[model samples]
Target chain A: MKQRHYKYIVPILLGTLFSCQKSSNNEDFNQIVEANPIETEVDVSSEIAMQVIEQMPSPLEISAIIKKTGLSYNSGILNPITHMENYTTNSQKAINFGIYATDLGYVNMYNSSQDAMNYLETVSSLSQDLNVSHFFNFELLQKLATNEQNLDSLMHISTQNFEEINDYLAKSQRGDLGALIIAGGWIEGMYLACEVHQKSDHKSLREKIGDQKVSLSSLISLMNAYKSNPDVELINKDLMKLQNIFNKIQVKEHTRESKVIEEDGIPMYQDKKVLTVMVTDDEINQIRTLVIDLRNRLVK
Target chain B: MTLKRLFISCFMLNSFIMSSECNLEEFSKNAAQKLAGYTYLKTYKLDASKEAEIEYSYVFSNNTQYVLTLAHELETTDILVSIYDNNRKELCNNYDKKGKKYFQGIGYSCSATGIYYVMFSFKNAKNKCGASVLGFKK
Candidate 1:
């Protein structure tokens, strides 16, 4: 009886020791990320894809252009800040975050601090939900939102944060979400431009809308990389519809004259190609309608 | 159980790993200061290779004023920024016609609506990591 009891106790002790050893090994493996990480084979295509995505212009530029037109703030055109709860999925949250960010930039351009706060709150909540809030400086943003006089600082900080967030997401292997954020922002921007065009006749603004044809094509090609994602595929389908309208807008390019000019005693090289957008009012109307429909689908 | 303890310990250690190695935040903040009065547009990290030229393809709306600035860890290396048109023709490099190659930035008044490429590389030594920022004015 004594020998049998000893045998049972020994086996039990051995089992617990082995379990502890295995756990320790697992912990060590996890800690390797902090140590000198082993460099994995670089995926050139994926790297190129991220580079292209990051290369896309910030929507704030478009919003600033819109502001330059002296248009009044149309809160109805923006996605409601209260719709924070509506974005339940990761994809929806990411896309709406982009929409709200563009809206925030627009509001900042107009010096609408009160409206900016609401949009900022919605954006912060979404960022937190997506676990990318670390990249955003909420405190600084809040301070800027309250102080409308510092509009330039607000714009700079907001744009920089978004780029950082995109970088972090791409580095973390979430490039698909980064692509969606860009797609969402670009669509919202084009929608805003088209809406403004619908209301007023600004030739530059119209040209800006037509010029987005190039951006839209680039965005679609980027989306194609992540077409395996159902969410991305659906967005591509909607954009393709918009693309069909964009295809009708013709852009004629002229030969670039390369020259160097002296400005302020500094030699400035000029090698610019002039492109004329030949888009009619009817096509503009089509773009406006389709953009509104697509934006509605996204925000809804 | 020991497994539970191990999981917890691993998570704690993983947090340390996530703290960041390059401190891009501090670098970006410093870069933002250089772009004063101009609304920031985008920031990029410079690859640590002199021979590795990275081209960023973007669209500059017609008649827009834009500027691009490059920042680097001065103790380690320097960066060169350049811009090109859709036809891949060199528009301007930070190195001016007066033989100034150390300038870390360039400004372009975009007069056309088309794709533009902003390329970056190191100047002296290779593998000099840095950051670049873009801003625009109306």
Candidate 2:
């Protein structure tokens, strides 16, 4: 027994020593790994997925159009900053983050500093809850909001901050939360359009509202991608009801020629297409009702 | 020296190589610089090959103005950007009135509300790498 134990110990010690010396040096380790390139399958699906989500319209565009329509800031139509506390779950917080972001955009476009500051606070809170506070510069944004003259810079900063937040979420494998934020923003934008259109008749704004059918489809597709998540399933079900209504709306597309013209020695090209929305007053009313119901479910 | 340590180093090196391949972070930073002051909506990476076109479908609302900016290594690459309506009709391409193809950006004032596609590709690009940023003003 003693002889056998000694024989085993000698070989074990020799093996350990050889192994340590083999990879002990940094240069040798590097060379060994270099000689045999490690196979790593790069997955950029997260980046691509985020890119697709970003393609969805920014609620800011809708808010900007509403502003251009010569409409005053109807504070009543927006989600109140007070509702910020009701969002307890990650899903709720994510969606409300989107909702507050749209509200902030509307207020900013109208140069309503007080409302902007309020919504900014709510946005900061939601972002913090989601652990994305690092992307949001609350102090800087507050100072920018205080000075109305810096609206452009403020918009730029806010947009970049959101982009960073979404990117970080995607990288961290929390893309589902990012999607909820976008869906929330889209729903709020739709709600605003429905609300404003119900109040006034602006042909351009009507067309813009009707055009949301396409975006709604995109949003549904996005949500459907994560239908397995219970939170996502609930949102998907609600959006599908809107999708069913949108299916009835017809969009007539006409081909048009695009031409490039020279302006100040630069080539300027203006491409326009003719799309006629065939939706009756009844159809829009149905949409408006559903939008209110959906948004209420989110806010309440 | 241990098997576990060797495996860990290999994994680390693999991640390093993967990131170093395209360096998307660097590309995004460069693109972000060009899109400064503009509210960035999205960024798309264009492959270096002229034939490698990337198309994105977006809902371009009416009565709003959109600006699409392209960023690339100035000395190494050139990219062409274009927009088309839902009807597959070309709205705008980064081409001069003289039909010259050298251009970097296109601005579209959308008067019609519908879905549109923004397409990007390299134009006689030597490096075959770059990105484009989208911004809109209402």
Candidate 3:
């Protein structure tokens, strides 16, 4: 009876050991499979896939387009959309404005030159084409070449462009239309001043471009000197108005857009918000003062 | 018997743990050094004028044979290039032409190694230009 009992227990223990070994091997195989990186082959629909690929942005091509636009603008073959209207507006507004302003400093400046007045009268008929205020400045510069009386007014007008530009810049963020317009006017003013300096051999006018810095006060001073007639009280009054406006400007920073994200913490490209901007109120008073100063210098 | 088996198993496990710990320090040290040495360089502008002299220095490894480069949109109407050895002895001067415009030519001998200088001189020019340099090593 004892032998029979031992034999049964030994067989049962052997069977249990074999079963445990099999379960351990199965667990090990499962763990190895789980640890390996799995790659799934997705069978994309050719028609849909091709359409999606075509719609993706090509960075190289986009950059090339932007470069071409810049080149065209630089070459003057294509007037930038930002200033196209200014080129077409009444040319006389510029001539009249320039001559009248300059006369305030030196009455002799416009004595023999009715050329600017004539040009202004001609341009007034086409005022609809002018896009920005600087277009008027350009005409004024052209008239100033013949009419010396336009110098003080030209200075007042050009200086106002700078003040208005700074105001616009203060109110808007970088890359905005306001910034582009301001840059356009600044370039126009600088270009005119450079041309005049080259033609007349004016050392002071030439020096204006040398520093490469643009400020309201500096521009006002430049205009004051270029007027060249100390007897003119109107020029002095305009300069003071410019100073008052520049002192009151203030700027504020703000975020204009926010990004959208996916539920899994990944950013969604289509929902990306770009462009940060800051606005200020201090420059507006300067702009108003500049405009008033320019008008006062020109109307008289 | 049970105590002896348990002790042997613990001893084997301890040995495995200690060996892995030793390798971890070496791997981390190498990673830290590599991260510390990396850097970035950017070029903003390069200008050459008739009034201003151009100064340049270059180096080559033992196997380097030849170097070729191109300069475009030069501010000067004419460009002249001169190469010199470490002792300041003149090596060669070459004139490069593209259509009606002339540029600076760049070339070197294979047997030369160490530091060499190339000077570029120009006259009456304007606008921004680009330069591309290509070198061969043995």
Candidate 4:
């Protein structure tokens, strides 16, 4: 009787242990990420990719530009949960992770507690799906979101978590995911910028929108690193099209000829070094339409 | 009975591995607060592996006032932070070249939108384990 029971217990125990080991590996994101076997010539080293990733502006910084325009808070722009169903690929999940997090940044800046909580949940969920939940302090973020007084703390913590996530992903084997995250945040920021321009028609905001051309170049470099991945390729392709439009927009610099000059026994740093973004209303409209169209499809 | 022992052992190993990841949020948050009135933007870590000097880059926005500061484990540090533009032009350094002094932080208001580099170096100080924070005000 003991010998016969041995076979049953041994097999069942081994199966349970195997399942535990699988989940403990934390490769859930790999399943959807490696969906495509297609190969391409484009490749970039982690060091190069990380440089681009770090060089890009923080998600909060991008959101800050939008807030600086004094644009009214519009919850309707938040990526609806219905579109989340389309996130069947790792790149999609990573991009939406950035998109939702950008929305969170925008809301926190506006002090929208209800919207902040909702976005916190979404960001947390996507982090888990991307197998990077270990970096986020969801519990602490939840506490901070509950009180308006903790808004700054909430912003800093939330930004810190995502920043760490991006840093790690850029250096890790999933460098593509990191690039996609940056790409997603940028697209959402652009979408919001376009939306804000439509309502407020803020001049500084328009210059900032034109200034995105600089960031767009960096974002493309990051995406090109992972162009071999079909999902990343799709994103890079969309950005390349946007790049065509951006190519026409010229941002001329009005920098002081001298960096520092001695005046009356004192050195003075140049005070009026600014870029004069020469973006016409027609070009702005084109950027708005293309950004919205791409943003809508990705959100869905 | 042996199966039960194997299960427990696996569980313990898994728990240990999962708990090993470090959290640097507190350190970064504290470092960012030193920016004083400027909102936090980003953080850069300088590890022991970086020899003598390390460089990092950021694409700063136009017409934005930014500050960079470093905090280390030591009570005092000689880590000098410098800011530069894409052309390798040194915009400013925390070190007072004329006064022969080194400061832990520097501030620069970007007048143009493009890539900017920051370099950190120790002045005869061996410890390189520290982090720097970047904060901005529009």
The parts of candidate 2 lying over 4 Å away from their true place are A1-48, A255-257, A263-266, B1-40, B43-55, B73-76, B84-92, B97-101, B111-115, B124-131
Candidate 2, after superposition: displacement of residue A118 in Å?
1.7
Report the C-alpha displacement of residue A18, candidate 2, in angstroms: 40
Please compute and give the TM-score of the first chain of candidate 3 against the native first chain.
0.23
Can you tell me the CAPRI class of model 2?
Answer: incorrect
List where candidate 3 sits over 4 angstroms from the true fold: A1-213, A224-228, A231-233, A251-286, B1-50, B53-138
Tens-digit per-residue lDDT, B1-138, candidate 1: 899999999998887655424555566667666775567887766554433566676777777767676666665566667787766667778775457445656777776766787877776743356677777777
Candidate 4 residue-wise lDDT at A92:
87
The DockQ-based CAPRI class assigned to model 1 is incorrect
DockQ of each: 0.23, 0.22, 0.01, 0.23
lDDT of 2 by residue, A93-161 (tens): 998898888888888888888888888998998898999998888899999988889776677678778
lDDT per residue, candidate 1, A1-300, as tens digits?
000000001113424441111121112211222221221211213444555576576788778778889888888878888777888999999889888989988888898889888888888889999899987889998888898787667777777788778777766777678778888899888888877877888887888887777778777866765665689889989889988988888878786766765443323445446668898889888888888898889998
Q: In candidate 1 chain B, what residue range of length 10 has the lowest lDDT sum? A: B17-26
Per-model TM values vs. the true structure: 0.78, 0.75, 0.22, 0.80
Least accurate 10 contiguous residues by lDDT in model 1 chain A: A1-10
Distance from true position, residue A288, model 4, in Å? 0.8
User: For residues A177-276, could you state the per-residue lDDT of candidate 3 as single tens digits?
Assistant: 2222222233333333333333453433323333222133333322232122232224435545645643543322233333323222211111111211
Error of 1 at B52 (Å): 4.8
The stretch of ten residues in a row with the least summed lDDT in candidate 2 chain B is B31-40
Cα DockQ of the candidate 4 complex: 0.23
TM-score of chain B of each: 0.74, 0.73, 0.49, 0.73
Ten consecutive residues with minimal summed lDDT in candidate 3 chain A?
A1-10
lDDT of 1 at A282: 90
Candidate 4 displacement at residue A68 in angstroms: 2.4
The alpha-carbon root-mean-square deviation between model 4 and the true structure, to one decimal in Å, is 13.4
